[model samples]
Target: MMITEALRLQSQGSKHLHFLIDVNDEQIIYSNQSFINQFSDIKNPAALLPYIENEDLKYVMEKYLACKSGEKVEDFESRVYIDGKRHVYKIAAALLIISTGQHIVGCDAEDITDLKDYINVLNEHNKKKNSILNIVSHDLMGPIGIIQSLSGLLNDPEKKTDEQRLYQYIDLINRTSKKCIALIRNFINQEFLESSGVSVVKKKSN
Candidate 1:
């Protein structure tokens, strides 16, 4: 009756995986429908260790052991593979003691794979945006600085530049301006391709 009530109260037609285990025997006392459906092969709590990703296996095991040792286990997220597909789960567990002096560990696991993936996508996009801004700032500064320097030289009253030299500086500024325009176009194109999930191969040009 205790197991049944606990399962009903925790699961109650929820999609979250729920299970109860005998802490002493490390055996599954009961598993809700969602738990059974999601992990049909997981006979006991110990059996879940193999499914957890190697990097997260130790942390998850630590939490489980803490819960079994009568310690309050805080909720945590872990990555695991289910049927060859990677999934992230937010796990929470509590220890329950029945009237018979038996210790039961009740666990709840909520799948958050989609949420993690979305967050990862947003992070990648943010990184790309910052990278684009840095590259544009660095590349665009060179030609602009050259134009400014040439304009300063032309406007200087102390030094008289000959007509030929003046024409040379003006031609150089025109070429630099055109180069700046080309650079802007390239950056815009690259940003568009990246945002659209297209691969970009960077090449060097004069």
Candidate 2:
């Protein structure tokens, strides 16, 4: 016996939210226990539109319509509200033809809220690291340029005519070097504090 797409997907994962909709009347003909429990006896897919995030509603609706029109939809992520709490789902849909030659749209949605949250945390960490690198690069250039100019003067005999002037140049270079050190230390400290606030743990393995 050949298994239909809807049946195959339904058998694949028990935790997934699975449903089948009649393409003609757009009625939800079949729904798994998980879907009925989460959505509470919704008549059709359109009934769940209000629970989808506003920003994602348009895109999700487009995909839904495409599935209804017999188009295969790739996996897409969207945030939805279930029981007044936000959840992320990776959704996919495909056209299913029954033995009677009737067309149906098979949809499978997986809960991926935890995975999305983890990815977001990693992205935020990368943004913070990039910000620190940009600031350190911009802030250190000025002091480093000053030190280079002063060191060039000390190396040239023509620019070192007077002892007092030479000593002043050396002092300025010292102060500029200290400023660079302070800038580095301050940024390092801030980065350390920010990294400490993250939930990630560093483990060293030999």
Candidate 3:
């Protein structure tokens, strides 16, 4: 009754899946409909490796064998291709005993494709935020440094530069100060755009 109730609950949840495998044969004894639907071509359970992406196959099999051998195995998280699309699954396996006194391995698989995609989006946003901060920091320092240097030159007690050079320094300072104001405005606009809008990759031009 408990097993039936659990299987019913799994179907109701929709995102979760459960599987029972024969420990000695590695054949699937039972699986929720969701899991069976994913591998509709299954002639045998061992064909399972074909559905898993190549990179994840070895690790997944290793962990499954560990569970069968009664050794500690870390939970396996891997990607599988289903219906021509990639999906992520979090899997955990353990030993189980059926009413017929058969020892089997039970695996719980949960689809996490949506969660992974959401996390990727958040990571991109973080990158954009960091990019804006970096640009503002570097841009602000450049103009401020120019003004400080020019002011020091003008205040020199031994100011020996020609009158024309002094005028040139004053012009440079004016231009730098104006540019600094523009930089501040850009920072504000970039912040607003990035925080509430889609993350855009800003390319720097020389």
Candidate 4:
């Protein structure tokens, strides 16, 4: 009776909090606006039982029951569906002992979808940047090395007697070397600027 009254009061005053399942051994609950909105598609609490068959939720429920049986439960996390859309939830559950030896499990969930998406985007950007750097370093290094080697060969008087041809080779080497250096410098400068901007934005957010 007390559990019923408490649940009723919680449901009435705490609209954002929901009790999705109440079992003999364990229960499922969530207290988050996003979670509530996501579960609004469920016509009734009973409809949520089959959906909770997720591996993560199953693990959470097992741990919750163990804790209620006087076993220690460490913090756990799992993915759950809200409104038919899948989301990663960081969940924490605790056991409450009521009068008459009745045990109640309290659960809380936090949506980490946005955080996960942000991490994925960062990973993809890093992969693309690494690919571009590999191309620049390998493709540009070979030509630059060839230009320097040819310039050295032309500088050796023993190798060639044509002064005009030597001068032409020197000029070509100088122009190509300067262009390569400029390209590298520009790439480095752009990377530094972008890094600085990201740092500034992070600082502002903090």
Highest TM-score: give the candidate number: 1
Clashing pairs in 4: none
**Residue-wise C-alpha lDDT for candidate 3, range 122-167, written one tens digit per residue:** 7888997898888888988988998999889888989777899999
lDDT of 3: 0.78
- By lDDT, the better pick of 1 and 4 is 1
TM-score of each: 0.84, 0.81, 0.80, 0.57
Deviation in Å, model 2, residue 27 alpha carbon: 1.8
Which pairs clash (backbone N, Cα, C closer than 3 Å) in model 1? none
RMSD to true structure for each model, in Å: 6.7, 4.1, 5.7, 5.8
Error of 1 at 132 (Å): 0.7
Local accuracy of candidate 4 as per-residue lDDT tens digits, 1-206: 99988866655454233343334633344333444565654434445545553666567657756766666444455666655776666555556666776666555555665565556556765776797698779868976997978877977777874879878787888888888888788778867875675555445444
State each candidate's clash count: 0, 0, 0, 0
What are the per-residue Cα lDDT tens digits for candidate 1 across 85-140?
A: 99999988999998999999988889988767766766788798899999899889
- Which candidate, 2 or 4, has the higher TM-score? 2
| Candidate 3 residue runs with Cα over 4 Å from true position | 2-14, 41-43, 72-75, 99-101, 198-206
Higher-lDDT candidate of 1 and 2? 1
Task: Give the 10-residue window scoring lowest on summed lDDT in candidate 1.
Answer: 197-206
Residue-level error in angstroms, candidate 3, position 148: 1.0
* Candidate 1 Cα errors over 4 Å, as ranges: 1-12, 189-206
Q: What is the descending lDDT order?
A: 1, 2, 3, 4
Instruction: List candidate 4 segments past 4 Å from native.
Output: 1-36, 40-75, 161-206
